[model samples]
Target: MVGVKANTAAKFRLYPTADQAERLVSWSHTCRAVWNIALAQRVWAYGSAQRKTLQAGEQCSELTLARKEHVWLRDLPAQCAQQVLRQLDAAYENFWNPEHPARSPQYKRKSHQQGVTFPGQAVQIRKVSRRMAHVRLPKLGWVRFRLSRPIEGTVRNATIKRDGLGWHVAFGVHRPEPVDRHVNAGPAAGVDVGIACSVFVSTENEGRQRPDTLTAGEKQRLRGLERRMARQLTFAKKHNGGKYSKRLRRTIAQIAVLKARQARRRADWNHKLTDDLAKSHGIVAVEDLKVSNMLRSAKGTVAQPGTNVKQKAGLNRSIADQGWFEIRRQLGYKTRRYGGELVAVAPHGTSQTCARCGTRDSENRQGCGRLFACVHCGHTEHADRNAAINILDRALSTAGRAGCAASGRGTAQSTRSPHGQGSLAGSRMREPSSNVTAA
Candidate 1:
């Protein structure tokens, strides 16, 4: 592997005093205001008769004069406010890039949670005990936080944000990539992600489901809260001029709490699963899925009405809950960190192609059943497992014989490196021995 810089973040729970918390919230609001004002200025400049364009440098110069004139702008940290302008610059850059998917920058709503970022030089960290630490910010001095883990690299910057849970701080750190780790000699595995089973492994011959993060009662309560919120929103739109009442705000907070819990659980599971896979496998192959495309709205135009809209909606929800994109994201960095390789193969017809016989027929996957019976070759296997094997074979074939040898699965037949290597003569499929353990 080539030498490269490794950048990561260390996040910790912040414990701020009541006054400090209030101040932090005010700073967030100031940041949001700066962003909105700068965006508005850019829009106006673009629409002017001269068609003048405003960049961050010119806007920042204007901000400097405004800060001297306005006490409110002067109260916020100058660096923090500058960071907001930089972020706005980035947003515009992304929007202008043809390859970037971001849309034009928009005004920030009061409900949106915008945070403040300070340069590393302005922030200082001091460890007071084994479990607690203190960080000094521009305005907030020596705020305490839980020392969940040791900071492993030089701090590049720190961001302070408020979520449904509470205020938190994240430090961006930079470190040199490790150069002395042992070469990966573990077996290679292919993974299939699906709605029914969160993941299936070709080498392990098993499928695993994500354990329910929320209890049945909690889920029921969440549904009730959602329905109530909908009713409240309708009433507010009709009678209250579309303004959210205090009760509506409280309900929104409650929903945020539940959703945050679910997100944390899913993130935790993904981290553990990816860590294990990275450490155990020399090569990990998964389908390169375009989740956004898969989750596209099923509601067609009135003139061209779609079929099975309800069924597609349910499927979309299931796929989203599985967090396939998150899993792939974690695998990408974890593999690099663990001295392993991550391969993403095209997903076309993986489920329909038989891993054993190389047959491509829709009938191979019959009627949503778990079993996959190849119509042409009379081979049978778990549908997900079959797809996983195909994914691995595609990866191995693409990587050529070098990858096959590294995985310790190298054989004369496997070295041929055909497109469907899983169906190569002498290739054997392992039988399912046990269920995959949940993370």
Candidate 2:
């Protein structure tokens, strides 16, 4: 919000020809080769000197080291091999002395590795050929992409990544401003996220409804594929060591494809949901749910008070599928994109805390089916909606923004300001805390 800075991220799936695809695979191989070579050198150093860690200068030099064993670097162009080894060194260093003491860097396998980047220089596009790239690797040809989005500012290299369903190239750019900062300030809203209806709002239209984008049809297809996969099984030979048959392997691959497609669908749903909220609302309020704690708690599992173990497992699986982390990530970026504020309210006591008189002790309303009622002030509301409203109130109050709550009885209390100045914009009523009661 202070320093006006802009950046661009563009991703496009490459429709490479068969030859191009094979070339890309070879490029991947080259990257792996360079990394493995560097790794081998580091291992040898550690073994020879019996040292735990080696410094940058102490490590093998690019020229002298590559000449003796890694001759591939000499004939296959210097930049490619140099960048790969540089990345390998960085990876090894990071793992050896990770920022967190508890986290230890594990070995990286070459089979899964896909890319390498040069800070600001790899795959540079010339002025005349600004939109295309010439991949000058072993057998890779010139790969081109339609300039879907114009690239502004310095091209900070490119990364060719293998995705779940396809291959993609991402271009990171330092771009010019698209919209003014002042154009982004708007009304705030509280969001109650759920599986049934992704997000329920309590601002702007007061109670406007937005349906969950995860289609039922997509879910049915996923279930069907899973069932089909479960029905197919293979047993290894008792004497000779042998895995599943080729036909079975193909079946497993098909299941993997289906699962990946479902994941992509879910990701797209969350992105669109977060984008809409950020574009429309200036301030977004959400609870900082301890999802891990929830999963471990009694409410997270056990349908009917400890009955139906199978049902509880199904419930847990569905909860994990909802993609809570993805939602949070999208919201963070979306808020920044719109120049809006996103407040993650503390989720503790939000559900039981009464919005009317701020009383939080037992006697307000017993947790029955799915509703909340305050005994002291006699305020009643839908359980989830009430929690969301309370979260909204706390978020706005913390930021010095204005808000007020309505009572259950027909009468209204006078509006009070945080600094005793005036009521919030269109606030109906508010009251100071009084007698406390939980149920």
Candidate 3:
């Protein structure tokens, strides 16, 4: 028996008519209500051992009874509403599983419940033209969307999600990744992600640097807009019933626009960069950086306030703008599809560790310096570039181990997918890992 590979997703912008948009919004509200109601029911059930383990099917039956009493519940699509209960059940399972570090189920706020999933079998997509397509929902009928890319594989499921800009549809499909052994067939290289430059790539011949996502002018505008939005928020809170002023609303919209633009630019850059790397490298290595942990707020409680909170906040913003995690993720899938392999190496001492010599010392590097002057080996190199070199060596070593393991020799195996999504089953990715236990 042959096992099927996992499906990947592609997102596209949706353009619904005014009437369709209003209907979609109403559906979302109903879905949110259902999620909140189901969550409350579960929370209340925990009080009595008799009903503590209420199943999703039981809640779904209850929903059907409620719909009979209130036909308004039946106004929306049945399957979409039922998916809320399914999601709630999954949430509970995740919370209870010790291995899965997922948060317990919480009530969904209207602001956050902005997406709905539709089973692919229940919907149909038709390509209208080269740059146009239409998808049909249960009640919403046919909705138009910009077809930026062709739908290549069989669609498994589709989700409609509203972002800062507008609505988008993401389709999950199992498309075979085209492999080319000739692309990036050269020796493995290393990539270092940092603040000064988003990516510093080192090859056998030379190293290259990719600049930060935002320009100087854009950074200044972002700071100014953020400051303005803060002021607006404060002013809005002073009004009756905390009603936001027009200025506040306008400021928020403006901020959203800027953020959307930033997101687009960053996505574009990452896609191009990853594609190039996958097309060119036989093997690549990158640092396993915990972007979320690294960007955590430094400000603590009033009793024990954190030091350099403001400085840390700024650094967090800069690091987030780089989208290190996204790069790693894109690289994961791209490298695998493009006939290359990607491995992650620990980033602990890559910068300070002399690339030329096996030396690891904190004092080998100095403050706010890009030039790495190793004290022990008397080696000089760009800090990020040197780090890339070290990463490449580690990646090569990992690949060699995997190769040996395949031949029944090495003790360890590498299991990480080039797509960076961890396991096809969707597991949390950790760093300082050699990806032992190859798939």
Candidate 4:
């Protein structure tokens, strides 16, 4: 089968020597400074009488001159500093685009995570042993890294980032072969994501909950650490002129470590879940949820204070914990990789509408219960499962209209369909009621 080229990234843990690590940190700071300086220049240019917009090429020319004048900037790799300018330019371009969701570029703070990118020509990788590799970078040669997996294709670029855990390097590679050459021939499923249940599949008639990333003991320790950090912040503000003490900095690092652990665990679980869904189903359907809008704060203006502030806060936390957007993002690429299709449908009244009867009434859902009893047809089923079924039905109808087929390679793949008034009119599927309370 003829294959298409695809771009992917591979990440590994880096083990730098003490001096190299210090230099890496200093270079990150330099990059951050470059970003801030470029942003300030752009702002000044825009506000000036000429209102001239600075381009990356113009900034690079200026950066070359500045490097000649300053020894510190000269020590930093020229490519790395130029990359920062390019990133700032891209940020501004995204902000200017009406369809893009990115906000305007902002000044980088000292606390922000640090990273630097090197073009393909500036980085050279060499395999040292079965489990070790070495990458030669500009100004910093022969940094050893754990080869968790073999690099699959030609390296296009590499980015090094520092987090609470440690320094890591990610290589962007271009593969000659496509992720999936043949279309998938498998079953279809609709997934309904919720706070109580992480995923509910329409075909399975069951809901699955994600395991907690942090254990009970870890949660307690995290809470205690947060409280201690708050106390330290109070002391620093009142007595130390808002300067962080060594102990306070240590506490912050500890907190970052725990948070990173949780994030890694969550990402692992999401990857597993998405992989399974993509491999088993030729067509997977899900609600097109705007997670940012769902997570908006409910603290209204002082003139009209919001009600149930604490309840809203808790709901926001639950929504964020589920990582709804992350799931959608992973499913998007994974489905394509597995020769499957991912469909997103409007989620207007999936919960209230009956999957069997097409009845839409708010009274069908009584309180915050798992059971969904349809008033029109007297059909009762799990709320999430019913919603999932509705989502699948809508996706199928949308695909049918778009001339999609069961083989998964179709025009409807990754398409979003608006909710139709009569879309759920005849979606009648029967399943055993024994698992109505599975969640």
Which digits, one per residue and each the tens of the lDDT, describe model 4 over residues 1-439? 1121115677899999999999999999999999999999999999999999998889999999999999889989998898788778767876886644457999999998988877665777888788888888899988989989888765656788888899999876655546557677777788999988899998886798999999999999999999999999999999999999999999999999999899889989998999999899888899988787888888899999998888999999999999898788778767767787888899999999999989899999999999999989999999999999999999988876234444565543332112111011111112111210111
- Per-residue lDDT of candidate 3, residues 1-439 (tens digit): 0223225777899999999888778878888888888888888888676767777789878888888887768887777777677768767776786544357888878657378776555667877787888887888888998889877765655678876699988875555544433344455668888877567888633444455456888788888989998877777677646687887777777777777777888888888988888777767688877676898999999999999999999999888777787788777766656656778778789988999996988887899788899999799888888889999888667668446223321221133332223322211111111111111
lDDT of 1: 0.77
- State the displacement of the C-alpha of residue 41, model 3, in Å, after optimal TM-score superposition: 3.8
Pick by TM-score: which candidate is best? Answer: 4
Positional deviation of residue 332's Cα in model 1 after best superposition, in angstroms? 1.0
Better of 1 and 2 by lDDT: 1
- Model 4 residue 44 CA deviation in Å: 2.6
Worst 10 residues of 4 by lDDT: 419-428
How far residue 425's Cα lies from its native spot in candidate 2, in Å, is 42
TM-score of each: 0.85, 0.65, 0.82, 0.89
Candidate 1 accuracy as TM-score: 0.85
Q: Which candidate has the top score in lDDT?
A: 4
Model 2 residue pairs with clashes: 361-437, 361-438, 362-438, 362-439, 363-438, 363-439, 364-375, 364-438, 364-439, 365-439
Question: What C-alpha lDDT do the candidate models reach, one value each?
Answer: 0.77, 0.54, 0.72, 0.81
> Between the candidate structures 3 and 4, which one is better when assessed by TM-score?
4
Error of 1 at 136 (Å): 0.7
